[model samples]
Target: MSSEDFPAAVPIPVLATQPVVLASGSQTRLSLLRGAGLEVVAHRPGVDEEEVKLSCKAGGLTVEETAEALAELKASRVAAKVPAAYVIGADQMLECEGRWFDKPEDRAGAAEQLRALSGRTHRLVTTAVLFHNNSRVWHQTDQAKLTMRTLSDDFIERYLDAAGDAVLTSVGGYQLEALGAQLFTRVAGDHFTILGLPLLPLLGFLRVRGVLPS
Candidate 1:
């Protein structure tokens, strides 16, 4: 979607100094932040995500906590390099029952994940953290509940064929914003959050910090 299609609900003041840096390589997140009228610089924070997740799991952190920790780690890493700029970092996790899901490695893996999620509700835990001067200034976690329709083996095959490698890009093996929408029976949460960034709350926090006009 175009930036004009999702204008910021509140007024945004002109930034006087450094531009906001996005500590992620996600195109969706870059688009979302720019859509909200912020000049964003995309920086891929080279974080060992699997290691962090494993550490968090070993520490008994909840899915939400793990997501936030990952986000903070990315933000802090980027912030250390650009201490003067506002750095935004984000991460997402998928959980069904007590099991956590990771992005699939191949088409077969994606199909397996989809089959496991068939007729079941799963939660997408998305978290964002903002940092400035090498310190975390704001953070938020949002959850989206998605219910996948019961799928036959044939349907899974066809869906995978149509989705191609796109399904492997998301933790849940689906992207609700695209053909992946057809896989779900219901989605209960913010659209931006499902897309991997909690834009509304992030913007609200920016406003409170005077990064945007209140």
Candidate 2:
């Protein structure tokens, strides 16, 4: 986006408060926070994502439950250290039918995901949690449904060649904001939520908590 897009300068909060901490090492999430005018401190809590998901499934948790559980675990893991400081934790899950899909492993995996999702609608369930002083203060989960435009093998190949290894980073091998937009015929939900953070909801929590100027 260009400066012209934000002609009205955003008011930067000038207050002495603990910096907001992000509990995951996601560049996209960091960028989102910065774009929203919040001073953020990102901390990657080294937890096993796969293990958390597996445990949720073993316990027969629903899609939203599973995502929330993962977010809580991530925030709680770091909350133990940052007393009185707010830490944000987020998690996203891709579900097609009854199966959970993860980021593709390689080109072949990307192609496989594209094939499975061709002409089908899938849900991306994202959860965001705020933790303070070892307590769960606020959290939310949003569901986004995207219908893939019928994909052709040739187009998939071209997309893979253009996107390269980046496709391996997101479930369904697509980023809705970039070249991945070409893969979808329709999407229903807030764009930020689809990207993995429900910015408005999270920001609302911060405002209510006096973390950001009300």
The candidate that achieves the highest lDDT relative to the unseen native structure: 1
- Give per-residue CA lDDT, model 2, range 1-214, as digits (tens): 8988887966665442447888998889988887787888888889898888898899999989999998888888888888678999999999998989988888999999999999999999999999988889899999999999899999999999998888988888998888999998899998999999999999887888887787
Provide the clashing-pair count of each candidate structure. Answer: 0, 0
Query: What is the TM-score (0 to 1) of candidate 2?
Result: 0.91
Model 2 backbone overlap count? 0
Error of 1 at 154 (Å): 0.8
Say which candidate scores most in TM-score.
2
In candidate 1, the residue pairs with backbone N, CA or C atoms under 3 Å apart (3 or more residues apart, or in different chains) clash, namely none
lDDT over C-alpha atoms for residue 184 of model 2: 88
lDDT of candidate 1 over 1-214, digit per residue (tens): 8888996786554442336999999988988888777878999999999999999999999999999999999999999999988899999999999998999999889989989999999999999999988999988999999999999999999988898988888987788888898998899999999999999999888878777767
Instruction: After superposing candidate 2 on the true structure, give the runs of residues whose Cα lies further than 4 Å from its correct spot.
Output: 1-18
TM-score of candidate 1 to 2 decimals? 0.90
- lDDT score at residue 108, model 2, on the 0-100 scale: 99
